[model samples]
Structures are given as structure tokens and as C-alpha cells.
Target: MKTLRFVASVSFGKDSLAMLHLLLEQRRSLDEVVFYDTGAEFDCIYRERDRILPLLEERHIKYTELHPAEPFFYQMFAHPVHSRKTGGVHKHGYGWCGGSCRWGTTYKNLAIAKHLRGYQEKVVQYVGIAADEKNRIGDKCYPLLDYNMTERECLAYCYEQGHEWLEDGVRLYDVLDRVSCWCCRNKNRKELKAIHDNLPRYWERLEALEAVLGNMKGKPLNEVVSCS
Candidate 1:
């Protein structure tokens, strides 16, 4: 019989980080930790990874970073797409990932899933969903929910352990609800306004992409933002 290998997937978000922390605290048999990089994540996400690397090394846990074969801009701006409806090829890449076209997430998931297939042992995947998010909990093992941890409690626990998402001297969780991809269209107006106000460099990149893409969520980027 093949041995079971426990692998944890972490996005470095509060819930994921807390789940890893709990796994460590409980002395769970974690063989590996996988992180999928979209290549468009916020600087803070990378910083958090740096903070956690030493700990993973100390614990002798295998740390694997998976990335899409194509860069984010290439996939979003240059990749060719077939148009069966028009019977013609669309020269431009898929626009901002929102509504029904979340190509970015699709790419991330495919990369992670493909990497997981390489394991010879039976893989037991661990997700970071919290107890509060029962709707998102599927068949995957969620250590956070198993421990009865809520999102707020997870964030608090991460802060207690000196883990934070900070960019430009600004605490990200203080402003945006999520600290994932800076260019994700799922971000709401409030989150966009926060980015425009706090992170000008990233905001500039957003503006440049918007210039090429023309609009975000069916309206012009500036019009969609229109921050006062």
C-alpha cells in the first residue's frame, strides 16, 4: 500500500497562513506545502512568503512554488484566443478576469493540479478555508475549519505571530479585504479606491493595463474607479 502524503496549499492569506500555523502547532504530518504564484500578486504576498520560508526550512517541510508557464501579461494581453462565434480568431488576449472569464484562476489551478499529479504517494490536499466560509468548503481537508477557526480569528492569530501583509508601509488588510493579485477585477470599488490612494506604483500599472484593455467590468477603468 502506498503511503499518504499530506500537502498544504497556501496562498499566504490569513486563513491559509493560520491553517499552516495550526498544522504546525498540532504537529501534523505535513510532507509538503505548495504555493501557486499567479505572477501578478501583491508585493506583500511575496514578503509573507519570505517570512515563512525560514520556518518551513526549520521544519524540514518541502516547499514548492508553482508558476504558470506563461506570464500574467502574456496570458492576459498577448495570448491568442479562438472565437467560434465569429468564426475568426481574436488577436487580443482575454481581458480582465471577471464575470465568466476568470482565466487567471484557471491557469493557477491547472498548474497546481498538474504538479500534484507528480506525487507517487496518495496525496491528501489541505486547503485554508475557515469555519465562517462553510459555503466554500468542499471535499478538501480544511485544517482551519477543523479547528473551528473563523476568518477574523485567523487574521488575529496571524497578526499575533507577527505575520502581516504590508506594502509601502501600509498594512494591506487594513485597507483591502484581500491581498491577492493587484490587478484582479474581482476587487470592488472600495478596494480599487484603496489601491489608488495607497499604492500608486501598482495603481499606475493598473492604469497602463486599462489603457490597453479599454475598460474593466464593461466600463472604462477611470470611470469604474472615479475615486473622489
Candidate 2:
């Protein structure tokens, strides 16, 4: 049998970070550490990601940055816009995610798996959904659920060494409980308002997106960006 490659999927979230720590603590080797940059995440997420990168390198782990064929906006939204007047790069063939317009996490993982499979013989992926987040768990989950790490513990472990979740964690955490792609329609009014309050430029970007896309359904495209 081919040796199974261990790959950890991190989104710069508490659970994923904790999962990585658990793997390291057990001395399990990681063939790859992947972060999918949809280019839609909040600025803080990228900042937090920068801080996490060096730490991984310090441990001799070389991380991978993955991107979809196009930026998240083009693939997820603009391409699917029904009207020609919208004016954005898009194709009219397969149906898009639609409505929610939230980029799928499954797609992100699939991208990593597909890219690695071309070069590697076998791959075993480690997902970071915490034990407490049962709703987020599904098949091929090898990190948090298998190891039984809870969300609370994930947060605690990531913060244990101080320096703000190993540095810069607190900066985003102080402003947002859990940073995600700032434009996710799942974000609540509070989160949208927070974006306006904290990052005015980003708020303007969302407003511009709204102008181009118009109502996602009942509200502007930006309204439903996330659940938060």
C-alpha cells in the first residue's frame, strides 16, 4: 500500500489551529499544511495567516497556498449573475452555488486533495472541525473529531502561549469573534456593521459589490455574506 500522506486543512480558525497543534504534539508528520485563500476573507484573516506561517516554518513545515481558477467573487457570484449588464467575468454553463453565494469549504478541501493527488501516491486529510461543532463534521474528518478536540479547548489551546493566539490572534479576535471571508452572506447585520466600523474600505467594497450584483434575492448581495 502507498504511504498515506497527512494533510491538515487550516482556515486560520481556532479549531484548525488547535488541530495542527495536536498533530505536532503527537509527533505525527504532516506532508502538507494547506490554507485556501479565496481572496474573499477579511483582511484580519490574512494578517492572522501571516503570523501562523512563520510558526509552521519554524517547525519545518512548508505550507501551501491554494487559489481557485478565479477569485472567489468571480467564480462564486459574478459568473452566475443572470444579467448581462452586470459586467463581470463569468461563463454560462454549469449552475453555480447560487443564492447563498458562500464559497463551499468542501470545495476548498477538494482543491487541495486534487492538487496533491497529482503528485502524491496517497493522501490522508486532517480537518479541523472541533468535537463541539458537530454540525460542521462529516466524512474524511481526521483531526478534531478523531482526536476528540472540543471547540472550547481549541480556543484555549491556541491561546495558551499568549502573544494572542500565537500572535495577532487577539487583534482580529478583539474585533470579531471568528473572522471569516468578510463578504460571506452568512454574516449578520452586526458583522456587516462591524466591517463598516472597523474597515471602512472593505465596507465600501461590499457596497460596490452590491451595486453591481443588486439584490441577491430579497436584499443586496452583501446582506447575506455570512451566518454571523
**Local distance difference test scores for all models:** 0.88, 0.67
Stretch of 10 with least lDDT, candidate 1: 219-228
lDDT string for model 2 (133-182, tens) is: 78865666567777777876777787773425222222555565566666
* lDDT (C-alpha) at residue 181 in model 2: 64
Candidate 1 lDDT for residue 31: 92
Quote the positional error of residue 228 for candidate 2 in Å. 12
TM-score of each: 0.95, 0.75
Candidate 2 has what TM-score? 0.75
Flag regions of model 2 displaced more than 4 Å. Answer: 76-100, 103-107, 162-170, 174-177, 220-228
